[model samples]
Target: MSTPRYALYYAPAADSPLWHFGCATLGYDAFTGEDIAFAAPAGCNADRWPQLTAEPRRYGFHATLKAPFELAHGRSEGQLRAFAHQIAAGLSAVPLAGLAIAALGRFIALTPAGPSPALQTLAFDIVQAFEPFRAPLGAADLARRLASPLTPAQRAYLEAYGYPYVGDDFRFHMTLTGSLPQDDVAGTTAALGQAYAAAVPAAPAVIDRLALFRQDSREGRFRLLDSFMLGR
Candidate 1:
C-alpha cells in the first residue's frame, strides 16, 4: 500500500460558488484530482495564470486546519479516520462573517473578513487533537523548515506541532497564488478581489464540515479522501 500523507482542511462544499471559483482559478479540483479550464481574469494575461497559480493549485483551495503529515508508526489510516470523526462530533460549526481577497506576504489568499474566535479555537483544537497521529518530521523535513528564518515562537511551534504555523501563529488563509513578482502583486490582488466577489457571499460562511485529504506521494496532488459533518 502507498504511504499517503493526510491533512484536515476546511474546503467549501462542492456545490458552493466558492468551490467552483476556487477550483477553476487553480485549475485543479481537490475532490476529483482533475485539471479544469477557466478563463483568465479580465485585463490579465491568460498565459501567465497557470504559471502564477501552479504552486497553490497542487494543494487545492482550502484553509489548513491540520497541516499534512504522514501517519506515525503503529498507526493505521482507519484509526485516524475514527479520531477525526470523534473530533468533528465534539465541535460546533463556526460562522465566518465573510472572506476577502488579500495579500499574504507576496502571495494572495482569501482571508476571513473579521475575527472569529470560534474558528481559531477549532483550528487550535485540531492541531492538538491529532498530534499523536503525526509522524515526527524526518531529518530532511526538519532541515528544510529550519532553513527558513522563523521567530522564536514559530520555531517552538515547529518543534511541538511538526509545523511552524499553529496555535497563536495561525492565520486562516486559502491561498490563491505562489509568491508573485513585485510588479504583479497590485494587479493580481485587484483581479482576485473582483473575480472572487460573487463567490464570497455577503452573508456568513458556515464551517459545518471537515475534510480529510490524502497525497499518495510527496509529488502528488492532494485529493479529498472523506468528509465528516460538524456538530454530529
Candidate 2:
C-alpha cells in the first residue's frame, strides 16, 4: 500500500513565522526565510547523548499531540484534514503568555515557567481529539523502543497507552539546544540564548492554526505541506 503515511503535528504554523529561532538553534531548517545553517557552540553537540535524550530523537523541535501517525486502514487524508479543522475550531489560542528557557539538565528547552490553563487544555484537546486517527504502533517503532529497554514506568505507560509520553508526563517545550559534553555546555547555552533574543521581538497573543506535514516518500525530512487555521 505504498507504506501509507501521515503525521499528527503540533500545528505550529502560526508560530512558523518565527519558530526558526527555536528550530535553527537545534539544527533544523525551519521553513521560514532563506534556509540558514547554524552550529552548536560548545556543549550541545547532541551527537554525544548515549540514549534517546535528544529532541531530534524523541520529538523534533515541536510539541506534538501524537507525534504524527499513519492513518489506519480504510482512512483517507481528506477525512483527516476535515477532522483536524474541527479540532482547531474547538481550540482557543494556545496563549502568548511568554515562555522561558530552562535547563532540562542535559538539554535546553522553552517551557512555561508558571502554570497556564490554556496550555494544558490545548495539549489535552489535541491529543484526545485526533487520537482516533492514530494507527497501532508498527513493529519497527516498537522494536526501536524495546531496543532501549523501557524503564518500569515507561513500560507500564506504554502497555496502557502505546506511548511512554503523555498526560501527566507531557511537558510543552520548543527544543533549542541538544545535550552537550559537560565542558561545552556554557558557551552553547549563551549562543542559543542570544539567538532566541535576536529571533522574536515580542510574543504574539493567541497562537492559532495547525500545520500538516507529509514525507516526500520515506526517509525525507518532514516538510510543511499545508496549514489549517483554527476554527473554519
Candidate 3:
C-alpha cells in the first residue's frame, strides 16, 4: 500500500461496555500484529458467522461519520491538530437517542431509533466544517474506487471525497456484519434482530465524547488515537 493518508474518524470508547459488547457480539477480528492478517473466533468460524462473510477484515465495528481525508495543500500537522482542537472546542455536545441494530443494505448496522437531530447535524458539521482541510482526490484514487459498481453520482463523490458514501448518499450506520446471502437474508435479519433485542439495553445513550482512531495502513487493526469530551 502507498503511504497511508491521515484521516479524522469518530471512534467508540476503547474499553467502554459499548466497545467490548459490540465487538464481541459481532464477529469482527482482533489485531494480531502490525500486519493485515486476522483470525476468526475459535468457536465461531466463517460458516457460522454468515453476516461477516462479505466484509473485509480490515474495517471492523467503528462507525465512520466522515471518512478520513488527506490534508489540504500546505496544511501541516500542527495546523491539523489546531483544527481538531478548535472543532472540539466549539462543537456542541451531541445528545443521542439510543441507536438500534438495523439492516444497512446487506449488513447489520447501528442506526438511530428516533430522529437524532443532534447526531445528524454533528455528522454534517464534521464533514463540511473540515472542508478547509480536505485534500483533493486524484485520478489514480478515483480509478481505484471506481472498481466497484456505482452510479454517476457515486463516482462523483469518490472523485471528491476519498470515499463514495456521503451527502444524500450517506446514511449514518455502524456496520455489524457483512452482506448476507439471498437464502439467509430474511432468517439472518430476524436472527440479528433477535440478538440485538436480547442484548442492547432499552435505555437512552447520551453522547458525551467524540473518539478519534487510527490504523497503521498495512495493519488491518485500528486503535484508539484520542478522545475529546463534547463540551456542548
Candidate 4:
C-alpha cells in the first residue's frame, strides 16, 4: 500500500453542534469515515442534493489549514506528527466569531461574520511551518493545479508553497456544497441557511485544535488520523 498523504484541518469538535450539523449536511464524517443519515433540507429536491454536495462531502466538513501533501523524501509520518505537535503547542486558539452562511464564488460556505486577523495569522503560520515536511509537487500535480486560470501571485504561491490559495489568499471557509449552477445557487443557499440555522453559533467558535487527516490514495477519502490541541 502507498503511504497516505496528510493535511492539517480545522475540524469542529466532534460533539459540537456545528460538527453534527455540518456532517449531516455533507453526509460524511471525516473523523469516523462514516456516511451519516440525514433528511434533505425543507423545500430542497432530494435527488439534486447528492450531486450538489458530492465534492465537499468527499472532503468532509472542515476548513483546510494546510492542503494535503505527501511527505518529503527523508521524512516519516511520525516526524510530521511531532512537528505538528510542536507547532500546536506554540500557538494559541483563535476565536472565530459569528459564522454566517454566504456565497463564496459559485458555492456557499460558513464564513466568519467579521474579519479575524488572528485566524489568518494561524493559517499562514501553519502553512509555513509545515513546508519542510511537504514534498515538492510533481509535474502532473503542478499541471493539474494550474489547469484553471490563476493570478500571477497565485501561480507564484503555487511554486513556492505547493498550493495556490495559501498565505494572504487564504479565506477561512467550511464549504457546504460543490459548485452550484447559477440558477440553483440562490435556492440552495436559502435551504442550507434554514437547515443549519440552529447549528450556527451565536458566540465565537474557538479554533482550539489542528486535525491531521490521511488519504490512502489520490482517489481515497480522507479520514482523521489524529488531533493536536492548540496552546498545549
Best by TM-score: 1
Estimate, for each residue in 1-232, the C-alpha lDDT of model 1 and write its tens digit. Answer: 6578999999988888988888988889999889999546777788999999999987888999999999999998899999989999999999888888899889999899999888999999999999999999989889999999999999999999999999888999999888999888999889988888755566678888899999898888999888898999
TM-score of each: 0.96, 0.75, 0.76, 0.96
What are the lDDT scores of the predictions, listed in order?
A: 0.89, 0.59, 0.61, 0.88
lDDT for model 1 comes to: 0.89
Instruction: Report the C-alpha displacement of residue 118, candidate 2, in angstroms.
Output: 3.1
Name the regions of candidate 4 deviating beyond 4 angstroms.
1-3
Compose the digit string of candidate 4's lDDT tens values, residues 22-97: 9888889888999987556788888778788889887788999999899999999999989889889999999866
What digit string (tens of lDDT, one per residue) describes model 2 on residues 12-67? 54355456555555455434322344444335444543232334523335555555
- Any runs in candidate 3 off by more than 4 Å, and if so which? 26-57, 76-79, 147-160
Ranking by lDDT: 1, 4, 3, 2
Query: Which candidate tops lDDT?
Result: 1
Clashes of each: 0, 6, 2, 0
Once fitted onto the true fold, the runs of candidate 2 whose alpha carbons sit more than 4 angstroms away are: 1-5, 11-17, 26-35, 39-61, 146-157, 216-218
